[model samples]
Target: MIFRLSPKSRRNLSRIIPYGVIWLFLGWFILTLEFLATGNENQRPETEITLSFGVLVFASLAVFIAGLLMGVLEVFVFKNLFRSKGLGAKIALKMGIYLLFMLILNALTFPLAASLELGTTLTDEKVWEKFWRYLGSVTFWSTLISLSFHILLSLIYSGFSDHLGHGVLLNLFTGRYHRPLGESRIFMFLDMQSSTSLAEKLGHQRYFDFLSSYYNELSDAIVEHEGSVYQYIGDEIVITWETEKGLRNGQCVACFFAMRKQLESKARYFQEVYGVIPAFRAGLHCGQVTTGEIGALKKEIFFTGDVLNVTSRIQKLCKIYGKELITTQVLKDQLPQAMADQAQSLGDLELEGRAEKIELFSLA
Candidate 1:
């Protein structure tokens, strides 16, 4: 049952379990102190001490149960609330809500536990006497201590959890922490031609392994070329390099072809081992894009605007035109005169959304 916890729940449990265990030990320590001080197995100590200890035990148990329930709730029920928001905001909101809930639950449990005392003398006379005397001492001190402990735990849990969650989500969303935005850049989208068919033939696990290797190789190549990976959509990888470099030297384009040859070699190796090879098609274009973090609780880096959309459209055209790689006129215009001759024009092609036809070229 514990293993069945969702990723988010598991994260919450990780934060709560350590503190909960420590408090459990502390509760036991307090009980031991009470026992040693009283020197009685089953008898109450001083009326004041007994009430104080009882309140301490009750609060400790309340905290434990509340932490468990709240951890689970945060994992499953409130998971979406943390999605799409920044790490700081998400952690703060969750901890604030959980702490508030704990306060309410602990407050309600006080009267109930007091009412259900067994065996001991807690009559109207004794109870009234104990209540007034112990109330100021036990209630104030314990509440302050519990709240202090809870705040400390919350801060630690929120800080560490937010740090990790934010790092991972940032990678998943934008593929980097510091994303450059609102700039003209060369965007490339590479996709495996028949990934669905390959997946069907290879089975889920094997196909996933193939995708892992494919993405790894592609990412390595992109990084080597000073390109940033924006995101992946199934078998497709969206990447970007600054237009200044891409246009000035055609280094990014050269890197793309070089990576293709490396991938071809990898395909041959996979074919020898698994009797199958995956083919890929890629599209490149140069234009402006807007990039930034998006979502509320589970924040992600996002790239939007025409360049990203057009790059993807051009990649789709690769499948239609039966080409390995395609580039737009924007890319051709930017390339050096010597490098420009290496590319062959495919003339103007009408894209799905654009009213004006886009000029296409094939990499030689």
Candidate 2:
């Protein structure tokens, strides 16, 4: 109850607020701008682009709550329902839904806004005329604003989708990788344990569905930890981050624990749906790699170096060590001192295909 949000509700509440703030600013700014540009100041000075303390506060809050509700419904309920429908239809549906939300929100909030002016938004004319005028203006603006915002935003997201990770889109456009750049990065290679058995048990289509559902659940943890998903190779996912960002606060290790916790929390759901709970073995490593754009038909950012190879080899050692999480000495040494107790040194070992041996640790 620290923020008056119950422990059970804290995570959901935290996710909603970030999206809520975006919606709040968009709604309030648009409404106020409309009033400033077209509202009749002489008729109602109090409500015409006037930012009274009570009106601004309550109006923004009402719209903000509506935004939060939209975010919750979109993420937890309606997101998956938006399937392979084409871009145009998706954009239309989103704008239409948001416009409906705005209409209802404005209906409730207008009264509060008028109260600040000691006046009503209604005209002293026939009831039907005032109603039609109010409804028309609200609906018109909501439609116009939502259509522009959602469609434009949809286009931007589509552009980003063509590239991997969040910032790759910008990197491509800016020619950031015209020359191969060497970067020190931390990588965590996660592979499903006994994936072959699980695939055979679930069958082809059902197996595909299982991975889809499992990855969807893990996505939240991935984003929360700021881990960039480098690629997905079948049941394996490679996550990478800059050395400083990944090692800072031991985020790279914490991400693994968070993902495990997330899946464990959903253990019952998986069992009921697929009759199996998925498990993963991860290997973490750090090294320098060259990054550059590759491929003509399909543009892509590729990372190449011995680091990837060594990381995969370490993941293979997980079966021998009987450990869920394994890390190279290089990565573990960079970790914060607080995490020292959690890592048990397995001593230096020769990883196959490489001449030299390196220290390895199993993270408990």
Candidate 3:
């Protein structure tokens, strides 16, 4: 079987790699400046530059390794603690912790590197003296300043990425959608059933809290199925996937059931929290769309296509058809054999605004 990274893992790697590259370049640039500032009187500039480049490779590699480790800690460990905190709190806490980690790493690594250069054991008196001397030097403080800048950048990027979906941040930087482009995509429009009544029953504030919990609970299944959350409009969430990704192992269809299962698993919690278990209906459709960047004040990647409207129409029909999940035949035909076999055809149906009739399926 071919190995593939889940969407979350790929997103984490995209976040982690930039830090290493930044450190590699920054380390080389700083070391070159140091050589130019404190070169031997007899040594030529070119010769000094060449020697500095040669020695800096090892140091740069060490810095890169440190960056990667720190990235892992920030992405996997610290991220969990950041969920409830505000931006200022997150930055301050990360800076303090990262500064301590960097100090500890530098303290141990400097001694090890020195011991290797002098060909002596770590317990040697010379290594201890050198390490203690370095603590008071300007270089040590400068290193801390560099690390502080790196941590701040990482935190800022992390916050932005979280706010604007991970893939969106990368695309914005790369300018992938600067020009309008046509592509095939699968979209799923999911909305809470009887949301108006539920809101009236629970009141505005309690309904908002219930909606938050509902979306949070279903997020795992969406991620696992490689779905990108496009938008959340009121009680409706629009999810999208690339054509190939959604078809793989019938993920588009499977995602619906997985989300249903997740909610069912959390039935008790929902019942206790809101005195009701939230239920949802979804419609899946796939087609071509023109994608491009839009908005001057607050930019976003916008998708313009009939498929979005058609998907919404299909979702609205779920109540009339009395089905939990409904999908277009165009999507059902492309699903895996096992998944496709479970589809119960609803025959040709007329959409609200379109003259053309469409074949729909309800997944069992």
Pairs clashing within candidate 3: none
Best by lDDT: 3
User: Which digits, one per residue and each the tens of the lDDT, describe model 3 over residues 131-226?
Assistant: 777787665777789878877777777778778977788788899999989999999999999899999999999998899899998888898888
Question: What TM-score would every model get versus the actual structure?
Answer: 0.52, 0.67, 0.89
Which pairs of residues clash in candidate 1, taking residues 3 or more apart in a chain or in different chains?
A: 82-297, 83-297, 83-298, 84-295, 84-296, 84-297, 84-298, 85-296, 85-297, 85-298
lDDT of 2 by residue, 52-149 (tens): 66666876787678667766765566565666676567656776776676567666555555544454534433333434455556444654565357
Q: Candidate 3, 104: how far from true, in Å?
A: 1.1
> How much does each candidate deviate from the true structure in C-alpha RMSD?
15.4, 6.1, 3.6
What would the C-alpha RMSD of candidate 3 be, to one decimal place?
3.6
**What TM-score does structure 3 among the candidates reach?**
0.89
Model 1 is weakest, by summed lDDT over 10 consecutive residues, at 42-51
